[model samples]
Target: MNATDFIVSRNDLQQCKSIETQPPEAAALPADALLVKVTRFAFTANNITYAVMGDALKYWQLFPAPKDFGNIPVWGFGEVIASKHPNVAVGETLFGYFPMATHLVIEAADVTKRGLRDGAAHRQVAAPVYNAYARVSGDPAFTGKQGDYQALLRPLFMLSFLVDDFLAENDFYGARRVMLSSASSKTAYGLAHLLHRRDGIKVIGLTSAPNVAFVKSLGCYDEVVTYDAVTSLPADSPVAYVDMAGNSDLRERLHRHFGGQMKYSGRVGLTHRSTSPEEPELPGAKPSWFFAPDHIRKRAREWGPGGVDMRFGAAWAGFAPKLDQWLTVTEGRGPAAVQQVYLDTLNGRVPPDQGHILAL
Candidate 1:
């Protein structure tokens, strides 16, 4: 098999590189491993977020790459072409976090009705949520129908759903208005869609002028305003700020404007990759990075085992059907096509409503 890997410069992520490797026979795969032939995955700003925070989150440690290069993690569907594990058979499909490569060998363990976690030695310290792969045949969200939608939104929307639930559970930190930066972002929209339905609080979307119309069309936010218009919002009202854009200046502006009324600041993503590294504080509650795993663990304790799955699955069912109204799935095949999609996402060249389904 000739498998290709997409690598990005640690210094300049905008520059991408690909390496193709030829493997021996399938019989050469390790006795306890499964070789997955990656089928499809979504390449979005979320993947950029992973690249940007790779070191901090230790994502780069998951699938090691050569010096000066990083292998960005992605969520996708893959079929096991060769396996030596007793429980996992060849031909079974799995969906979970995977590197942007044509093939991966998973040291499978903890096999269950749901799926098995990749027990690769390097992954022992990684978050369990990303380690577990679900068999599509058994996964209610991806079974047979709607597999495209699942591949596109499941990873991101799950984070959005969890973030919304976390904020709601905490009563939006006593704020009557919820402000989301990067409203055009898929994760931002998913949360906005949920908050828009909540009573009392207003869901406000902050986006660039170019994306203002697109964000407005989602109808997920009660109000849509460009970053230039952020000052138009009242300063005295209690507000919960969700910083999905991760631009330092934008965050500081919101902080300086809202002052103490900015009830909570959650630093989520850096879609604006040029965002300043040094934080300039003005006035507000301290911004906390929203690590999805921590929140997921807390909720699991409060809601019981599999509680998240039950709630997210129900919400996903309802939201999945409505995707056609907002998103377009575009298929890109082979290594070259996949490379272009990766570049498009890194350079923020992809359209707001288009979801790239990369196949290899």
Candidate 2:
């Protein structure tokens, strides 16, 4: 069967194409291999962050592509059209990481009734979370609109959950307030949601003027301020900054404004792509990148097996239902629709409340 992939230029994300190619033959499948038909996936600013940080974070290495082009990874559901593993069967559906393509061939290892890991050689160095897939039947979040919510927000929310857990584990670095930039983005608001629920810590959201109202409507932040108002916040209060926008100027402003009062500066997403990679030494706390996978590994050892899941699952239960009130899902099908959504997301035209679920 022909597989169509949506790939973006590593040098210029705006330059993209949907290329059609031949997939592995189902009949000639290797042992323990499964051919999955890509159903649908969510497109968000998070995917754009993957492309922007592709080289720096090895995101481009996840799925190979032609020279100068890269396949952006996504979270979604797929059906197994062919299977060579005895434990896995055709027609079973799975929810996990997938390329923006029509099909995928997975070398299934560590198979279980719940799911299996993609034991492909190229993916070994990556985080296990990206390689793992869950069976649809076994995933409680796979039902009804919950599945779309899962695809759209679960991965991002997992990052939010981990960041929240990490901060709490460290006693929030002795800061009384936590500030998140790009507050309208999924990950930012997701973190805001968790932080808002906790007492003794104030959650502040930093966003663009256009998104200020939307961010405030989420009602998860104690205060929502625009980018220009960064200096308006009390500079003397001890606070933690979550750099979700990755705007260099804003980062410098926050650091210089707060000076030694900025207890922790944790860099997260790059929703704002027009920024230099080289960080200039500024006052206050040094900026450190928060890699969610590393935190997951640490928690897995500390919390033991299923401990993180139990905690995250309980948190998700509370957060999932809130999406129905906060997000509007928009469905698109075929290559043309997929390309439009990709370009819109890349160009920052997508509204904060709208979520796109595309099928190829």
Q: Which ranges in model 1 have alpha carbons more than 4 Å from their true place?
A: 138-140, 143-145
- In the range 1-360, model 2's lDDT, one tens digit per residue, is 688998999998889999997888988989999999999899999999988888877878888899999999999999999999999989899999999999999999999988899999888767889899998865656965789999999999999999999999999999989999999999998999999999899999999899888998999999999999889999877999999988999999999999999999999998888888688998888999999999999989999999999999999988987898899999999999999999999889999999999998
lDDT of 2: 0.92
Q: Model 2 off-target regions past 4 Å?
A: 138-140
Per-model RMSD to reference: 1.6, 1.0
Looking at model 1, the pairs that clash are none
lDDT, candidate 1, 1-360, per-residue tens: 588888888878878878986644678877778998888777888999889988888889888788989989888888899888888888898999888888888988889877899988888767898899998655655754377778778888988898899899899999989999989988999888878878998999999999988999998889998999899899978999999988888888889999999899998888988788777667989988988999999888999988999999888876887788999889889878988888888888888999888876
- RMSD to the native, candidate 1? 1.6
The residue pairs in collision within model 2 are none
Worst 10 residues of 2 by lDDT: 136-145
Each candidate's TM vs. the true structure? 0.96, 0.98
User: CA lDDT of each candidate?
Assistant: 0.86, 0.92
